[model samples]
Target: MKWTYTIQTEGLTVEQLLRDEWRLSKKQVHELRMAKGILDADETPIRWNEPLAAGTPVVIQLADTVSPHVPEPNPDVSIVFEDDHLLIACKPKGMPTHPNDPGQSGTLLNGVLGYVHAHGGTYAEHVHRLDQGTSGLVLFAKHPVVKNALDRMLEDRQITREYLAEVEGNIQKNGGTITAPIGRDRHHPTRRHISPSGQPAITHYSVTARRKGTTELRLTLDTGRTHQIRVHLASIGHPITGDELYGGAADSAGTYKLHAFRMTFIHPFTGKKLTAQN
Candidate 1:
């Protein structure tokens, strides 16, 4: 489709015309140039070096066809809790919070934006994070005060997080604590491992049920670290079932059986204790 606009300036160069009259930015102009979308006032494709008179009428002929390689992303989200100052949601496993790679576009943020747009659009922000493969209750704030308060609580260990997981071995005791330091795996870029020289991490585990071959445990994190449950459990010889990273079964489809079961925190705005269990 060709859109025509009258040139107000009589003899400015085509570059100058685009510079002043284009609604999009200069970078957009360069992108349009790359797309071969820029044209002359005479409806001809103009060279980059071409100059134009100020008053020349410009015609920008855009193609009707859409680019096949570029896919349009739709925004979406699932709301777990909502109030004047915060919105909480359960992030599904295997979806990213934000776009990291070209393959990841439609994300939790996109969905939240769509939700905001639908509900009269309030000021909202994500306060914390969960890995792409972890599913859990995550909080978002409508006010910076709420966010800052939650950050303080998290820092102070006031927020309690409990998780459930099925691991490969039979956890001998009913409950035990793993006081290991966690650090990035030196050999693997995509995983975290326990090391003597890493940051302090405390993971408390209580055996919930014992399957003949596998043991299910409730893991409460004393200090949240990257892959703390999987790493700590594996450090003690019980890698999470299906967690292929720190060594678990790849044969079963139900591997890496970790679930965020409960979260406890005082309401940032109301000053009341609030708990969400999933």
Candidate 2:
């Protein structure tokens, strides 16, 4: 893959520009230098410490490496958004985000790979993940530069994630916040619970609708803990209606009532506000 950038500030060496303005890590710079990936507008090689005049265009070409996994095509996979820099998809319930164990198939990652492959592309790097039981919008980067930019944005909390869940029982309050600590369940290896010796978590919820023996909620999280939403809701005596593992009713569909409804963030390359939904 290749990307080009126009030099906006003059007198800065390539190393300085990449490190300070582009916010590239030292390791990435080293890789580019070692691979002879930097080039001037005229396709001439450029050194890491080489200084360029203003209006100079720089090109970076990444190394091509073979992939160990090949994803099979699935007609069910839905592509919600795409561009030269990013690809967004809406994953259905029951599909794992990626393969956690060897020989695993039918994951969202596989589906994305197949989609990209169908378009004569070779790579797809996911920026974040959603659990298997949750259905929602997922983002994938087309190149290492785009992936790096997204990772930084997520670390700085520039991406906003929202969800809709159906919980058991009626919530008395119209809306409220749940501030608690979440940690691994002592007894269940695959479960999470509220504990004193856990990471800080905050969940904001508002009642959206109510039905007999069930309530709909709009939830937002301040921290992205492993089962944070499920644990927090269960702690308040309102486990998700179909979350059998979390002490809610069994679901015949083999899925939960949780859905990743919306995501709001700034496009790293275009500087445009993007709002994606299922």
Candidate 3:
């Protein structure tokens, strides 16, 4: 994969440009140096100590081999949106966002890296994360500046996220807001629960459909937290179907019925509104 960057300021060397301006890790810099992927705009070879001036463009090409941390890319991963700056993909159920163990593989990140490699992109920078069982849209930033900008937008809640979920039992209210504090479960290391000392979480939901034993809901989050929706819904006696970890009833579908259905946000680079859905 090849990436091009135009030098905006003067007096920076090639090495400084890669490390400070572009935010490439030391390992990546060393690899690029070894591969001689760093070159002038004219495609001429350049040394690490070469001085760069304003308007000079430098290109960095990534090696074809997949990173050791990620598994081989699988082409079957679904693509929802793609542009020069962003990639939105629908993560399949049962795929973790990233590998969590030494021998772990087959994660969404691995698949994304594979796609990027195949398509001539440089890297995968995730804007947000989803649980393993939740099938939904996942955003990937193509560069560092875009990733940084989106991170700020997420921190300010400028990104709008909508989800669809099927929960056990009928809800008494057609629409309501759930304000609760969520924190890590003291007993179970990987679970979350409501607690007084936890971070504040707010969920707004409207009943959309009713199955024989479950109600489908359109849910919006005011604050994103680990297991916020599951914990809040279970606290209100409507845990998601098939989510036994949170005391939910078994689902006939054999999979947790939750999907990140929609995301709307302003484009950081183009200053235009964008919406992506599953």
My TM-score estimates for the predictions, one after another, are 0.68, 0.88, 0.76
Model 3 quality (TM-score): 0.76
Best by lDDT: 2
Which window of ten consecutive residues has the lowest lDDT sum in model 1? Answer: 64-73
Query: How many residue pairs clash per model?
Result: 12, 0, 0
lDDT of 1 by residue, 114-146 (tens): 565566544455666676766777776654434
* Model 1 ranges off by over 4 Å: 1-77, 101-104
**Model 3, position 266: C-alpha lDDT score:** 86
Q: Which residue pairs in model 2 clash with each other?
A: none
Q: Candidate 3 — number of clashing residue pairs?
A: 0
| Top-TM-score structure, candidate number | 2
lDDT of each: 0.69, 0.83, 0.81
lDDT of 2 by residue, 1-278 (tens): 77777776787778887677656667887887888888887777787787788778888778754334567697878888898778888888888888777667788878888888888777787888988888898888876766777887776778898999999999999999999999888899789888999999999999999999999999988888888898899999999988998999987776789988898998765557998888
Report how far off residue 75 is in candidate 1 (Å). Answer: 9.4
The better candidate by TM-score, 1 or 3, is: 3
